[model samples]
Target: MWVNLGVILLQFLSGSIMYSYIIARILKVDLSKIRDGNPGASNLWRAVGWKYGILALFLDYLKGALPLAIFVSLGIVKDNFVISLAALSGVLGHAFSPILRFKGGKAVAVSFGAWSVLTKWEAPMLLGTIFTIFTIIKPKGTTVQEDAFRVILGYLFLLPYIIYKSFHGDFHLLIFYDGNFAVILYKHYKDLWGYLRGQS
Candidate 1:
C-alpha cells in the first residue's frame, strides 16, 4: 500500500513538471502571453518554431510514460489497480499541478503518455484513431473551442471500452478512465462551454 502511494506520488510529481513551459522559458518565450495563454506544446510551435515545440511535446509525453515504464519494467509496481492509480495520478498532476499553483496544462499529452503505457498502447491507439478521424472532419486552424470539444468527444467515445472492461470485472481500467475523463473535462470546461454557446 505504501509502495503504491510512493509510486503514485512520484508519477504525479513527474507529470507536474511542465516541460513545455520550461522549454519556452529557456527560449525566453512567455507562453502565458501568447496563443491563448496555454503554455503548452502547440503554443511553443507558434512562438519558438516546430523543433522546440516537438521537443517539448516529446518530453511532456515522455515524463508521463517513462517513469511508469521504469516502475513496471523493474517490478516495482505490479498490481493493476495500483498502476491505474499511478497512471491517473500522472494525468491529474498535469491537470492540477502543484508546481504551477495547482494550475497546469489541459493534460492531453500526459494523459496519452500515461494511458499508452498502462494499456500497453491500446488506449492511445484507440484515442489516436478516434482523434484523427475527428480532426479530419473538423480540421485544425479552426479554433481552440473546436479542439477542446473534439478532445472531450474523443474521450467520451472511449467510455464504452472502459465500461466494457468494468463489466468484464476489470475495474481498475474504469477507475483510471473515470479519473482521466474528469480531469480533462474540468480542465477544458471553459472552452467546451464556449464551443457550445457559440454553436447555440
Candidate 2:
C-alpha cells in the first residue's frame, strides 16, 4: 500500500511541474495574459516563440513518460490497475497542477506521453498519425477552435480503434481510456462549450 501511494505521489508531482509556465517565466512573459489565457504549449508558442513552445511540449511529455518508465523499469508496481492509476495521476496533476495554484494545461501532450508509455508507444503513434492526417486535410486558415474540435474528434476516433485493435476484450483497459478521455473533455469544457454555442 505504501509503495503504491508513493508511486502515485511521485507521478503526480512529476506531472505538476508546468513546463510551459516555467518556460514562459524564463522568457519574461506571463502566460495568463496571452492568447486564450492558457499556460500550455500552444499559448506559449504565441507568447514567446515556437522554439520555446516545442521545448515546453517536449518537457511536458517527459514529465509523463519518465516517471512511468522509471517505476516500471525499477519494478516498483506492476498491476494494471496501479499502473493505470499512476499514469492517470500524472494526467490529473498536469490538468490541476498544485504548483500552479491548481490551474494547469489541458493535458493533451501529457496524455500523449502517458498513453505512449502505457501502450508501449502503439496508441500514441496511431493517434499521432490520425492527428497528422487531420492537419494535412484541414482547410487552410483553420482556426484554433477548429483544430481543437478536430483533436477531440481524433481522440473519439481513437477510442474505438483502441478498443478494436488493442483492448477488444479487456473491459478494464477500455474503462481506463474512457476515464482519460473524460478528463480531457472536462479540461477542455470551456472550449468545447464555445464551439458548441457557435462562438468558436
**TM-score against native, each model:** 0.94, 0.91
- List, residue by residue over 37-76, the lDDT tens digit for candidate 1: 8868878888988998899888888877868889999998
lDDT of 2 by residue, 74-113 (tens): 8888877788788888998999999788888888888888
lDDT of 1 at 182: 89
Scored by Cα lDDT, where does model 1 land?
Answer: 0.85
Candidate number with greatest lDDT: 1
Candidate achieving the largest TM-score: 1
- Which regions of candidate 1 deviate over 4 angstroms? none
Clashes of 1: 0
Please, what's the RMSD in Å of model 1? 1.6
The lDDT per prediction is: 0.85, 0.81
Worst 10 residues of 1 by lDDT: 134-143
Q: Which run of 10 residues does model 2 get worst, by summed lDDT?
A: 165-174
